[model samples]
Every structure is written in C-alpha cells, then in structure tokens.
Target: MTRTALRICPLCEATCGLTVTLDGDRITAARGDRDDVFSKGFVCPKGASFGELDADPDRLTRPLVRRDGVLTEATWDEAFAAVQAGLRPVVEAHGPDSPKFSASLEQGGTPIAVVLGNPNVHTVAGALYPPVLLAGLRSRSVFTASTVDQMPKHVSSGLLYGDPLAIPVPDLDRTDHLLIIGANPMDSNGSLCTAPDFPGRIRALRRRGGRLTVIDPRRTRTAKLADEHLAIRPGTDALLLFAMVHVLFEEGLVDLGERAAHVVQADEVERLAAGFTPETVAGPCDLPAASVRRLARELAAADSAAVYGRIGASTVEFGTLTSWLVDVLAVLTGNLDRPGGLMFPLSATGAAPRPAGPGRGFALGRWRSRVSRHPEAKSELPIAALAEEIDTPGEGRVRAVVAIAANPVLSVPDGDRLDAALASLDFMVSVDPYLNETSRHADVVLPPPPPSRGAHFDYAFNALAVRNQVRYTRPVLPLADGQPDECAIHARLILCLGGQDGADPALVDAMVIDTVLGKAVADPHSPVHGRQPDGLAAQLTGRDGAERRLDMMLRLGPYGEGFGADPEGLSLARLLDHPHGIDLGPLTPRIPALLRTPSGAVELCPAPIAAEAERLRGRLGAVPDGLLLVGRRHLRSNNSWLHNVPALMGGSNRCTVQVHPEDAARLGLTDGEPARLKGDGGEVEVPVEITDTVRPGVVSLPHGWGHDRPGTRLGVAAADPGVNVNQLNAGRLLDPLSGTAVLNGLPILLTPVR
Candidate 1:
C-alpha cells in the first residue's frame, strides 16, 4: 500500500517541509509539501533526495562493539554493556575533581565528554538528549561544532544583548535593502537565520525593488544574484565593517531612532570608529573607498536596511568584532527592532513574553580548556583544542569521549593528529547511523535508526526562523524490529553514564517533567502558578517519553495553551491537528523585553568588542601576500554527513580546489591537473578547477571531505574519497575572543604537482 507522510527535511538549516511517498517500511519518494506554512512547496536538492539518503545501504542497522580490537556487530544489550564497561573506569579513575576552572588539575570522577556535531540541531533525539547525557557525565571539557562554525556570533550576541540566545536576524521579506557579508544564503538556503527558499526570497526582494548587496571573497551564487558583489579580502570583514561605521558617523548618518532611548555607549562607538576610515581600510579589505562610502550612504538612506554576516565572517581572526559590527551598522541606521530591519524571531516553542527587565546576563570564560586554557564561550571549549586535551598528559586531560552524530576527523582541523588522538583514548563511543571516519575509532558505536523511522521537529531552527512558525512530523516508517529509535539510543547512553545501565528511559523524561512543572507552579508568572506537578504530569499527552516532553514544552511555550488557560493556544495535540504546520506570523519589534543586559539596554560598544577593534586597527597596514584559502558550500551537501549517500555526490558536489584562471596561471596550474595546496598544518594534492568565480589571489575548497581513512565502513564515501580541507588547518590560528578557527582567509602556498 502506498501512503503519503509529512516530514520536515532534516538535511540542512532550511527545515523545509517534505511529503514522503512510503510503501510499508520503505520511503519511495520525497517532494515539497505544498501546504507547508513556511516553505510553501519549496524544496532544495538535499530535501528532494530524502528517500535515497534514508535508505542508503551504508547506514548501520545494529550496534558495533570492539571485540579483539576489531569492530563487529553486537546486540543492543552487549553494546550497552561494552559502553558501561569502557566509560565507567575512565570516569572513576580520571575524572576532573571539579566542574569549575583551576590552574592545576585534581582528578576524581566523571571522565571528559565532548559533543561535536551539527546534527544535534537537526533531529529530535539530537536536540533533546545530549544535554541530559552531558549533565549525567558532568565533565568540564565540553566541546561543540559551534566553536568551529558559529561561536563568534553567539559571543557577539551575548556581549550586545546580554543574552547569547537573543540573536537578531534580518527581516528578509520586508527589508528595503539587505547587505550580506561572507554568507551564501542561496547555497546554504539560509543558516543561523532560518528562511525557506532563500534564493526565492532574494528574487522576491529584487522584484519588489529592494536593493541587495553581497560582500565576499568569492562571487558565490548569492553574490551573483546581488545588485553589487564586493569581493573583499578574506579576514578583513571587521575592517570593512568598521570603515562603513566610520562613513556613517563621518557623514552624520548615525541614527538610532527608537534605539536611542534603549542604547548605551553610543559615544564610545563613535570614538572606536574615529580612526577606521574608508581610506585606511580600503587597502586591507580590497574594497574601494568610494564603494565603502556609497554602501554606508545607501544603507542610511534606505527605507529599511540590515547588515547580516554569516560563517565566513564568524570563523576569522576578528570574528567577534566583525559580528558585533554587523549589528552596530544595523542599529546605527535605525533599522534594528523595526519592520523591514533586523528583528528577533519568536518561536512557538520559545518561552512566553516575559516582563521586560534586567536578567542574569550571559557570561564567558567561566572555565578554560585543560591544555591551552582557552576560555569557554557559551559553556563550550574551542573544538580546535580537542586534540591537545586528549593527547596532552595532565591530571584532568580528556580520557574518554562520548561523541554523538559527530565526524571531527573531517570537520575539525588537523585531522591526522586528531585521528591518532582518538585511537589513544581510554574509552570512546559514538552515537551515529554510519561507521564513518570518526565512528570507526569508537569502542562501541550505537547506530540510531534512519530519519524515516524517527519523528521530526525543528527545535533549534524554529527559534532562528525568519518568520515565526511551527511544524512537526511523526515517524514515516515503523522502526525495524530490535532497532531502537535515536531517542531510545540516547536515553540508554545517558542511563549508562549515570550508572543506571538498565533503567527505563522514560524515567529520565518523567523526572525532567516533574522538575519543570514544580518550578513553573511556584512562579507567579506561570499560568498554572498554583498547579501541582503531579496534576500537570497527568494532563500531558504523548505516545512516548520524547513526545510527552514535547507536549509539556509546547503547552508552556509562548504560543502554547498554558494547560487550558488559553484553550486554542499551542500544544502537541494542537500541532498534531495541523499536519502541514501553523504559521504564527512574521517577526515583530522585540527590544526591551529581549535585552537581558545588566543595564536592560543594548550595549552597542561592549568592552571586548572595542578591545578587539583596536587589534583590528593594528592590522590595517599588514596585509599578507599569498594565496588565501576559504571553504565553499555545496547545494547538495551539509558538512560530512551526506557524502555517504550516492545521490548527493555528483556534479558540482565533487571535491576540487576552486582557483581563478589568473591564480592558476600564476601558479602554473592547469585545469584538471593536480596541485599541492600547502597550509600551516599540512598539504594535499587536489585537482584544480580553474574558474573566474574566485578572486585572483584566493583558492577555495569545500569542507567535510577526506573519507579515505582505513577501517571505515562507509562504502560509497571511501570509494573515491575526497581530500579533507580541514587537514590544512593545524588548529593553530583562532579568534582570541571566541576561539573560532580561522577557517577563512588564511594564507596558504600552492604549487603545481608535476
């Protein structure tokens, strides 16, 4: 029998709705859901091939345990036993004495744990269970993909609004002018700032007579569609942005509008912008002084304007400074907290509007990594330092790792070293569906069922959506017999870490519900202020622990029902009634309530940002002369996970260095000929794709490759394994403020392979 099921595409950040044609347990086809509230029938290449990815033969169907130093198929019970046996000794013998930071290590209990994947935000099990597992393990040496990808933005948002989660996204649908820096929304389909059909949105803006400008080192797809493409030098975004600010201040275009009353340190911002004029930075940023002035002037003159920067801007030497300047420009032009400007997204699952007041503001450097003492940003250590923490000998050095859906060997810098470090771990476990580069080193690998066999929701992406909306999908296919869902797999892992190896996973969910309800009932602001925790638990509805938890969260969320206080308000039941999704509407002005700073106002000139600006000023005259390397995004792939799927591996998805014709000629490199690209860490000989898309002195390679590692079970990915670009990043260069790897604009030397 053929049946159609609604599912949210978990391939990327776009989170578009998908309709799957299923035959029993098999997913036959996938297409855009026309009735979806947000995407509205728009689907990308990654979304369209959902069925093929879901049914990939490379996916592991059973747990694998290392017996006799060789990974072999094992039963779930045997896998759990192996995990408990492997991790318990490491935790008891080598755990850090305290969660707090200290210069000297005093080890006692709780082995080091690290979560290093982007998939955590893409799936339900990924979003819900990692925190519980981490809490159970209680390790201070935490690491996530954020540091390598988007930690700078989080740090900048924390410093600006006093809350790291209080990120403001550009109002793409209504904006009159959109200035994008170092972002290819057309390729990524929008990241951090979630918007479905990003290319269509750009076209819509153009059709509506809105000016669109893109500033990047390469002429990306997004740049090709823009009104102007500023091919600025890599690692110089902060300089270019500060120069724009200088132009705004110099021309008397600084207007805060309503923000004037809620903003602090406007004068300090002006002082910081004093010396970084367009002329001073033009030489470093590779942008003309006239063009800088015109961009600033056009932004100030626009009916509404927004300055948005993404990964390219965030993963640089001056990442935090560049990120802060993005918002600084938005505020200076009076485009913040207004329609057609940069605004906060109110997700359905987010908390209800709280009283606008001072909050316990966000903080950084609460602790530092063991090896390098890199300050923790947003409670995560720099992923670049993961190798040292494991390899370096110390009292509190990382002895064990619990990696979930992560492939750090390909994703992180210096993969060769990290690969050896992983082999040296006292214990290692990976919760992933494939035995790829990273998982191949694990003592026990717990493979989660495919997306088709698991329910789906956009917990993280919804909070970052350009528009406020909510949608969900139950599992399209039944779980294979004896194959646990991801949630169950994660729950079991948490139980093992907590020393309750065989405990019912549902107890974890129940305990969380009781704790949340107990707190809510005591709070005067809660709708069920005086309600008993037991009563609320009884009222919750779901088929499983994960669903029940989701129900409780939805009922208490901003758009939720508040447990009958607002009958028509959101709930799991309410959402289930609407399969396509319910559009909560567009983003609105949210400022005072959103600001969590100690002063309860926007901190335009945070001291950290100002300090970094001074450092940026010091680099105005020192421009390195070499071929700078940057990573490019493919429309078909999302990091390292999709390469195993054969459907996404052809055409433009191939791994080859993108070099300009002029640069290729200068290096004596011919098209389709191999070239040795050397960087600080190492070198790789990759075929050259000569094109004018990149600037003359720059080269580009796509991230998430290098599938050639031995003992890996990924048949498709290992067949014609592509080179790993992160191998060139030795994990030496990092943004001091956020500890983000300088993935873009790093100087490299290229030589043609004879």
Candidate 2:
C-alpha cells in the first residue's frame, strides 16, 4: 500500500521540509511540506529529486569486504571484522582483543585518522556517533570537509566570540540593508547561514524596500538581485572589507549602539584599518574608490544592516581576515546583536546559556600535521595534506583511515595525487553508501540503509538555522531484513573500532547516556542539575538508542524540560506531538549574555586578525595581472554530491569555464570553444563560455565535477564526466589562520586550445 509521510530534507543546509509519497517501501515522490514551520512550502531541485536518489540502484545495499584483492559482498559480521583487522594496525597499542578499549586509550594511543564529510551532520548517526567513536579510539589525527570549505568562518568566530560555534546569521526578514560578499546564497541555499528558500528571502528583502549590495568577481544569481553589484578582484575581499571599515571610521560614522558595552577594541580596529582607505584599496579591488565609500556610507546610514560573507571570502588567502571584517562591519554599524541585524540563533538543543563571564575561550595549534606541520584549526588538520600524510614514510603516518561519509578524492585539491596515495595505504575503511571515488580504496565498505529507512533530526543545522525552531521525523519506512539503519551502522562501526567486536551495540548508547546524564547532573548550569542519573535514564522516551540520545539532549537543552522541572518546556515527546515543527520564534539579541571570550566581550580587534590586516596593507595596490580563478555553485548541484542525479544535472549546472568577453577576445577564445587553463598545480582544458558577467581578468569554474574515476558506480556522472576544477589546486596554497584551501583568487593562465 502507498502512503505519505513528512521528512526534513537533509540534502543541503537549507533543511527544507519534504512530504514524501511511498509506494510500499520505495519512495515514489517528494515535495515541499506546506505546513513546515521553518521551510514553509519551499523545495529546491535537490529535494524534489529525492525519490530518484533514494532508488539510484547504484547505491550499495550490502557491505563489501576486500577479500584477497577483489571486493565482494559480505555479511555484516564479516564486514566489521575486516574493518577491525584493517584498523588494528593503525592503533598498535590496542589490538582487536583488547578488553578495556576506552580506558586503555585514555593514556593516548597511536594516531587513528578520521575524516568526516559535510553530510555527516545531516543525520543522527553522524551527529552523535563520531565524537563517541573518536573518544573510544582517542586518536588526535583528524581532518574534515570543513578545512576545504568553511573553516575560516569557524576560526574567525572563535577569535571574535571565544566559541568557534558561535556564528551569527543575518536577520533577513527584518534587515534594512544587507551587504553580501563572496556568497551566492540563491544557489547555495545559504551555507553557514541556513535559511529555506534563500532566493525568496532576498526577493522579500527587496520587496520591503531594503537595499542589497553584492561583492563578487562575477555576476551571480544573488548578485543580479542586488541594488548594485561590485565585481571586485578575486582574493581581494580582505582589502575591500577593510576599506569599508576605514570609511566607516574615517567619516565619524562609528556607531556601536547598545552593543558597545559588549564589544571592545573599536579604536584598535580603526587604527588597524587606517591603511586600507577606499582610495588605497581601489586599485587592488579593481573597483571605484567612490563606490567603496558610498557602500560604507549606505551601511552606516541604514536603520539596520548586516554584512554576510561566505565561501568566497573563506576559501582565500586572507579568509579569516575577510570573515572577521564581515562581522566588524556589522558591529561598527550598530547591528551586532539587534533585531533586523546579524544575530545568533539559539536552537532548542543548544546548551543552556551559562552566566555571562570569562570562559574557556577557543584555542588553535595544539596539534600539527606531520608532513607540512600545518597548525591545527578547530582540531582538524587540513584535508589538503591527507595525501602526503599517507604516501610519505614517517613515524606517525596515517596508516589507516576511517572516512565517514567523505569523498576527499573528488572534493579536495590535488585529487590525482590523493588517488595515487590511496593505493599505498596500509588499510582503509569507509562508511559510505556508494563505492565512489574515495570509498573504492577502502578495505571494507559499510553502506548505511537508504534515507527513507532512517529517522531524521537537525542536530547541526538547527544551531546554524536563521530561525529558532525544532523538527523531528520518524523513519518513513522500516529497515529491510538484513539491513542496518544509519544509527546501527555507526554503532557497529564504533564497536568494531573500539576493539570490542560483537559487543551489543546498545552499550554504545547506554554508555553515552550515562556519561552525559552523569555530567549534566553535576553541572550547576544544567536544568537537570542535582538529579540522579539512574532515575532520569529510565524516563527518556525513544524507540531506539539514537532517538533516546536525542531525547536526552532535548530534555537537557536550552528549551528543554529539566526532567519535569519545567512542565511545558521542550521534550522529545512534545516535539513529536507537533508534526510540522515547533517555531521557537525569531532570533533575539544575545550580546554580553552569550559572550564567552576571556574578557566577557566581543574581541573587535583580535591580534591575529589585526596581523592579517597589516599583511594585506603591504599589498594594497599590487593585484595580479594574470587571470584569476574562482569557483561557482549551481542551485541543483552541491559540490560533487548531486551530479549523479540525472534530473538535477541539466541546464546551468553543466561544466564549463566562464571568461569575460574582453579577456576572451584578447586570448582568441570563443563560446563553446575549448580553452586551456593552467594553474600552479596542473592544467585543465575546459570549454569556454565568453560572457560579460565575469570581470575582465577573472575566470569562473564550478567545483565538484570530474567524476571520471574508473571504480565508481555513478553511471550518469561518468557519462559526461566534467573536469575536476580542484585539479588546478596543488594543495600547497592555504589560508594561514584557518588552513582552508585557497580555492579562489589563484593566479592562472588561459589560452585558446586551438
């Protein structure tokens, strides 16, 4: 029988609500849920193609073990055994037969590397399991997709707010003016800043007579909608932002408003930005000095304004500086923590706000990569260094890798090198649904069941959401006979990696519950403080361990009931009762109460940020004359993930390099003609589309293509496999503060292929 069910789309950061039509156990169709509180009725192409993705046929339903030299189907027990065998060598101190897995590792064992992908935070398994698994292993070697994408934002936030996770999103519905730099939220559905129907929100801002300004090298979908679009030179966002800051201070327009009490170092910021006057940065940014001054005056004159910068700002040489300046602009304009400005969203599951005081602030460089000695940011070594860490002979080389929902081969820089590096690995294991680029090298591939058969929760997205809300969805269909749910798959992986193979998976959840509840009761800030852990453990409600963990977290969260301490407060049971979602309301001001910095105020002029600014001051007018390269995104594609979905790979999503008409004419390039683009790493020959949308000395290439790997099962992607844009990246260039790959504003050469 066919039925309908509601689900929260985990395809992207938008986190739209989906109403799925199921025919028996198969998903037949998926559309937007009109009743959804956060997303409303907005659904993008990725959400609409859910059925095709869930039934791709190429998705592996069974585990595969590399028996001898060939991969073959294997039982769950055999698959996990193979994983244990492969991981055992990496953790020499703890063998598969070790009795005390967690305790033995407390003293610190040999490093076991782990790489988590962006998709992990979308599911309960990814959100709840990895931390526990890492703890069980006690390995310090860590890498994640964040290092290649959004690490700069996290680093900047840590330096500004003391907590790396304390990122602020613009209050789109109320802002009077929004300055967007290096971001195309209309296509990305917003990253770091999460909002459903992002384009619609931008349109709504215009409808309300609010002004929008875009800073990019090319005219993007969001840029076209702006009141004015400034095609700034690539990698010069730091210069542009600091120039605006200089204007804000120069014209006596420094208004911190009520947040002045919670923000410090205004004079320090003004003094540091003094060298980056509009006239000085105009040459580097390739924009008119008058335009830069006008933009600053507009922001200062607006009733309320927000400056939002994204990947374009984060994946460049001065990424952290650009990110920090985005917020500094907001703070200087009296928009830091006010309504109709950039403010932090308080999710239902966030830790209850602690008393405002000095806190344990964020720190970096506690660890470094062995090969490059790249300092750690957010406890993650750069993924760009993964290849050398494996191929190079060293004492603490990454002998084995636990890749969870990650595909670094096609996603990160220098894919060719990493592809060859994987062949030399001692052993590898991947928790993935497809034998794709990175997973094909794994000794064991454990595929989680389809999304239809897995429960849904917004563990990470909720914290980054533009609106304060909560939603939960049960599994649309039950798991098949021998299939394990996502949670069960992760729990099993944890057990096998912990050297306690065949242990009851339930123990993983039980131990987590005991530890969390035990700690919550001890902390005076928790609502459940002074409560007996054993008594509250029996009171949690859920059908499985994952749900039970969610229940515990919800009960102890900011909006949660303290084990009946607050009767009407949030509980998993109450959230379940509301089918659509519980709207916790719009973002409110959270200033000194949320400040965790050592000084109990926002660090307006962090030392590292100031140093980066002074570094930019040295290159005020020295812009690269050669063509610079930057990446672009499409509404239907999300970095290499959606290319396999045939329905989402049409029209504007095709692979081609965009060049300005003037540059194309000079290089003898034409529309639909192949062009050779060379970079520091290597060269790629892609079809050129000459257009004036891009500025004269810049070219735009989309990321997440080049799906021509031989072992992958993505039939559609391989049919017209595009060139991997990342091939041009040698993995040498990185943002010093955050270690994020400098994927944008890199010097490149272009010529007609002839």
TM-scores of the models, in the order given: 0.98, 0.97
TM-score for candidate 2, residues paired by index: 0.97
Q: Candidate 1: which pairs clash?
A: none
Please state every model's RMSD to the true fold in angstroms: 1.7, 2.3
lDDT of 2 by residue, 1-754 (tens): 8989999898999999999999888888999999999999899999999988888888898999998888899999899888877776556554324443344333222346788998898888999999998777766668899988989989999989999999999998899999999999989999988899999999999999999999999899899999999999999998988988999899999999998988889999989988788998889898999999999999999999989899998899999989888899999999988988899999888888888898777887776777788888987889899888887774666678899999999889999999998877888899999888899998899999888889899888898888899999998888889898888888988888767788988899999999999999999988878989999999999998988898888888889887898999898999999989999999998887787889999989888887877787889869678889999999989888778888898799989999998999898898998999888778999999888889999999999998888888888888878899899989898998899999999999999997
Residue range with the least summed lDDT across 10 consecutive positions in model 2 = 101-110
Question: Which residue pairs in model 2 clash with each other?
Answer: none
lDDT of 1 at 594: 82
Instruction: Give a tens-digit lDDT track for model 1, residues 332-399.
Output: 99999898999999988777777888877778777777667788888788889888888888677777
- For model 1, state the Cα shift of residue 209 in Å: 0.3
Computed on alpha carbons, the lDDT of every model, listed in order, comes to 0.88, 0.88
